[model samples]
Target: MRFGVAFLGAAMMAGSGIAHAALPAGFTVTIEDAGVKSASGAYFGGDINNYGVETFDSLSTGVHSTYASTFGGSPISGTYSNLNVHKADQYGGAGGNNNYAVAGISQTGSYAIDFTTENGESLTYFGYWLSALDPGNVLEFYKKDGSGGFNLLGTFNPTDVIAKVGNNASGTNPYYGNPDGTFVGQNKDEPYAFVNFFNETTGFDRIVFKQTVASAGYESDNHTVGWWKSQGGNEVPGVPEPATWAMLIAGFGMIGGAMRSRKRISVSLA
Candidate 1:
């Protein structure tokens, strides 16, 4: 059930223009940019052994330097310098109901979530809806070493994923006209995406979301985590359906044709 190169190759060939950071062998990443929170929930929350999503609805509005909660069956604690909870309508393309989202304010803005379980179980899957991506935003993953220290696994950002998945930040993006339509036509330049990280060989227990630049803010909602498992007791990662693959292939075909035509014109002009 580990989706390795064969699945990735099909996704690429089908034109599902998603890109990912270089991960350890047997790790993979998937991204969804065109849909709303429910879509991402279904994608990541289904057909798993355990799954949960943190919508930030119950938290009081304001800054939270330290927060603790349980997601799925995993106990999680978060520490941040300036994590602010704001009404979802305040930000364009922010996921969740009309509730709230956690934001890392500009300048020294960052948050870290540590999964603490006495059993020392690792999580093989993670996901979040990242809204209004800026160049300064970064997402880092870490694994706990046996000695209470954390080993950095990988670092990623929205721009890198968007470069592979094509920008869908326009008004046509479904999230722009979400329920209540409060965020319509706002923050059109910044893309919002649901990013999925999966590891088949080794799992991680720590994740960090930060904004490196002083000018930008990191806003996101619907933090999700899960352990991949099928009803048959086999480990299986969530993958795109056949219809999704067909759609991606058609989209990629068009893009490829356009690029080829542009290349021909450039050669002729040269």
Candidate 2:
């Protein structure tokens, strides 16, 4: 696909430090162009233990401090601060369709979601559709430290993805057009992408979205979470655990050899 080269260079330079500083030793980030559709298709497989998507459709329009919902049959409760749910058309970079999305508001230009599953399992994967990317928008992942504090695991933004994969060249006129057709021709100057964060070791449980500039907001939709599987053959460092290997073998046996042919990209942090 085609990308804006000039913008890509600038984004790379600006986001370089954030990527290095925020990503922990064992975490990786993957970015994919959704291309006129949602990225929901990428969230499945034997590798994922449990997964869910929060569409924000059921929530009322306003600031919510606590929200609970089930995604993909898994129960998830989230605590938020200064997070507001707005109808799609209410925001400039948002997708259309009478649907809804969440954004950070007020003086902070930031908001966060601290997630806890009903079973209290650690989350290994987090992803979302980032629309109308801006330099001010920043996303951070964190894990709970032993002493009731949190440790930052990674920091990312749409610009980082553009620096890697470039920008969407095809699709509607605006590269970042809403696949749902709600807000066509809007945010033409901005780029959009589906970003996935995976932790190879211990996983994270909290996500924070912020806008560094005053009055700007962080807008996103289809927040997804899952338990991810590592990739490797019989090798040592990257190999999956025995239990996971067993699950993969069993899954491949049932699904047939065709599933093994599907292509996937895995990025490891340096």
Candidate 3:
């Protein structure tokens, strides 16, 4: 995939001192007992036990998305290329709600969430739920490379992203067997499996989710509305951390002391 070399260089120069380590290869998927929750504005760092992990449920407005990217206080902001949102109903006699979750566009193409307005933050890890109603549906993740473009991170199976819904009893709709992994409820869980990458501290300003159409006319509805956690960048650190600031101040103090000592010695020697 292509990268934004110039932008990355500038970013590192500007904030490497405060930057965290790169996210490692592969991501983690946790099954939460609570149902998918929606969050807005800046993402607050979650509980300490989760190590600052914060989960957000992203839902589409059921309308065409544009550059502005706001669904009335939803944490989602991105463009939908030539597609509209779809809600679940009995499509082709399937009674499951997978076909009607947020971001459930069937056309299978690339969709993005823009966080550039939030000062272009970074994230170490990110995962979202996808509903591949049919077997052939596929999804992929990408992050901005910084040059106004995208870089592919990983490809996901609809099977891999199915939500674990026992935590929410209302979602109990029986689902067919998935070749990937079995779900807790016979009913399909709004898939929340996350693909972990080795880079643990690399913050991503934007996330791109792409869908692959199963067949010529048949489309798998995409659902990003379930809970998914991120490692960092819920709130962009516009300034250095306290420790970094302390180090800077101490460095300046040492430099001043050394200059003073050198001047005194020269005077004495003279």
Instruction: List the lowest-lDDT window of 10 residues for candidate 2.
Output: 255-264
Model 3 misplaced regions, further than 4 Å: 1-26, 33-67, 71-76, 90-110, 124-129, 162-199, 215-270
Q: Each model's C-alpha lDDT?
A: 0.52, 0.55, 0.31
User: TM-score, each model?
Assistant: 0.65, 0.68, 0.42
lDDT of 1: 0.52
- TM-score winner, 1 or 2: 2
Best by lDDT: 2
TM-score of 1: 0.65
- Backbone clashes counted, model 3: 31
lDDT of 2 by residue, 123-226 (tens): 88777767655545788888899899898877875445444334343433233444546566544445555666777888888888876533445667777787
Write one digit per residue (lDDT tens) for candidate 3, span 136-170.
23444456776878766654433232322212123
The number of the candidate with the highest TM-score is 2
Off by over 4 Å in 2: 1-20, 36-43, 46-49, 90-95, 102-108, 167-175, 230-270
